[model samples]
Target: MNRAALRLSARVREVLEEAARRPDRGDISTTTVIIWVAAVTGAVLIAGTIALVIAKYNGQLNNL
Candidate 1:
């Protein structure tokens, strides 16, 4: 059991070392930023529309 634990630790260390030595190609690019912004804007617009519809319905019910 101890030997197995040591082997696992060594393998993990090796993997971490290799990952650290790799190039930096995981940055968030401009296209990703634009897409995220668009997604957020669309979500806000949809939420606003739903709220407006609900408000309108409540207003109509109150008038009755």
Candidate 2:
């Protein structure tokens, strides 16, 4: 290839490599983490409705 093409390709490769080294997007985002934690917690609560003592203890067990 020509010198100009090689130079452009090298710069583009350098930028891509630098970007790949940083893992800060999509699944690792703050909102995604919060949503994942909330979903898991909700699932646990729903699955363990009978064993959720805190919920009953906080309220009067008679409510259930």
Candidate 3:
């Protein structure tokens, strides 16, 4: 198992829990799940994009 990732995940969950404690924050209350979902989704998409870009350029280098 990846211990570093596990620790990160736990920290993220702890942050969300803290956010949940404040019901008066309009944005958080109205779109709590949406916030985190978007964050995680964006992170994944960004990482994938970086991987894809690197792979594409690396492939081109082989022909030079």
Best to worst by TM-score, what's the order? 1, 3, 2
The alpha-carbon root-mean-square deviation between model 2 and the true structure, to one decimal in Å, is: 10.4
In lDDT terms, how accurate is model 2? 0.83
lDDT of each: 0.92, 0.83, 0.87
Indicate whether candidate 1 or candidate 3 has the larger lDDT: 1
What is the descending lDDT order?
A: 1, 3, 2
**Model 2 TM:** 0.38
Please say which candidate is ahead in TM-score: 1 or 3: 1
Of 2 and 3, the candidate ahead on TM-score is 3
> Candidate 2, residue 24: CA error in Å?
5.5
Q: What's model 1's overall lDDT?
A: 0.92
TM for every model, in the order presented, reads 0.53, 0.38, 0.45
How well is each residue in 1-64 modelled by candidate 2, as lDDT tens digits?
Answer: 6999999999999888977997553447788889999999999988798577666696776679
The sequence of per-residue lDDT tens digits that candidate 1 reaches over residues 1-64 is 9999999999999988978898575979999999999999999999999999988899787889
Off by over 4 Å in 3: 1-30, 59-64
